[model samples]
Target: MRFIIEVLLSGLAIFLAALILPDSAASVDGFGWAILAGLIIAFVNATIGTVLRFFTFPLNILTLGLISFIITVLMVQLTSYLMGSRFDVANFWWAAVFAIVVAVIQMLLDGIFGAKPRD
Candidate 1:
C-alpha cells in the first residue's frame, strides 16, 4: 500500500520533472511511461543502486559526497537506458539535472502529503 503510493508519487515527480526540463534535457512519453520508469528506478535503486553506493562509500568520503551524486546521475542514465525510448535523458550532465529535478519534485510531493521526517 505504502509502496504503491510511493510509486505513483514518483511517477508524478518524473512526469513533472520531464516537463520542467528545458532544451530537451529529458523527456517522458506519457504518464504511463513515467509510472513504469518510476517502478524500474525504484527497483534498481533498491538493488543495484544500493550495492553501488555501498562500494562507493569510501570514494564518496574522499570526494566530499560528490561521488554519491555521480552515482545518482549514473543511475538516472541507467534508468533512461533501461526504459529506452519511452524515457530519455540527453547525457550524463542532463541526467544529473533530471535526477535533481525529480528528487526535488518528489520531496515537495512528500512534504505536501504530510510525510513526517524520521528522527
Candidate 2:
C-alpha cells in the first residue's frame, strides 16, 4: 500500500514538474504517461541506482550527498529514454531542474501522507 502510494505521489509530482517546465525543456504527454514514467524511474532507481549508490558510498559521504543528486539526474534521463516521446527532457540542465522540482513536490507529498509523531 505504501509503495503504491509513493508511486502515485511521484507521478503527481512528475506531472506537476512537467507543467512547471517549458515545453522545450521538458514535457509529459499526460497524467497516465507521467505515472508510467514514474514507475520506470522507480524501477531504474531501485536496480541500477542502488548499485551505483553502493559503489559510490564513500564519495557520496565526502560530497555530502551531492552525488545522489547526480544519480537522480541520470535516473530522470534514463526514464525519458525508456518512455521515448511520452516523457522527454531536453538536456542535462533541464533534467536537473525537473529532478529538483519532483524532489520538492515528493517531499511535500510524503510529509502529508506520512505517519505523524504524537506530541
Candidate 3:
C-alpha cells in the first residue's frame, strides 16, 4: 500500500516538475513515461541507493547530508540513461534541480500520506 502510494506521488511530482521546468525535465509523450520513470527511481533508490548511503555514510555525515542530494541527482541521471528517450534530464545541473524538486515534493507527499493517526 505504502509503495503504491509513494510511486503514485513520485509520478505526480515528476509530471509536475516536467511541466514547471521544461528545459530541465522531460517525459516522453505521455504520463505513462513519467510513471515508469517514477517507479524506476523508487526501485533504484530502495536498492542501489540504500547500499550507496551505507558506503557513503562518512561522506554524507562530513557534508552534513548534502551528499545525499548528489546521490539523488545521480539516481535521476541513471534513470534517464537507462530509459533513453522515455525520460531525459538535460544535464547534471538540471538533474540536480529536478531531483531536488522531486525529493521535496515526495517528502511532503509521504508525510501526508504515510502519517500515522493519533489515538
Local error of candidate 3 at residue 50 (angstroms)? 1.5
What candidate 1 gets wrong by more than 4 Å, as runs, is: 116-119
Span of 10 residues, lowest total lDDT, candidate 1: 110-119
Candidates' C-alpha lDDT: 0.88, 0.91, 0.81
Q: What are the per-residue Cα lDDT tens digits for candidate 3 across 12-108? A: 8887787778754555445788889998987888888889999999999999998887887888889999999878988888898888777787777
Q: Candidate 3, residue 37: CA error in Å? A: 0.6
Clash total of candidate 2 = 0
Which model is ahead, 1 or 3, in terms of lDDT? Answer: 1
Per-model TM-score, in order, reads 0.90, 0.89, 0.82
List where candidate 3 sits over 4 angstroms from the true fold: 107-119
User: What CA root-mean-square deviation does each model show from the true structure?
Assistant: 2.0, 2.6, 2.7
Record all residue pairs in model 3 with backbone atoms less than 3 Å apart, i.e. clashing.
none
lDDT of 1 at 101: 90
User: Which one wins on TM-score?
Assistant: 1
lDDT: the better of candidates 1 and 2: 2
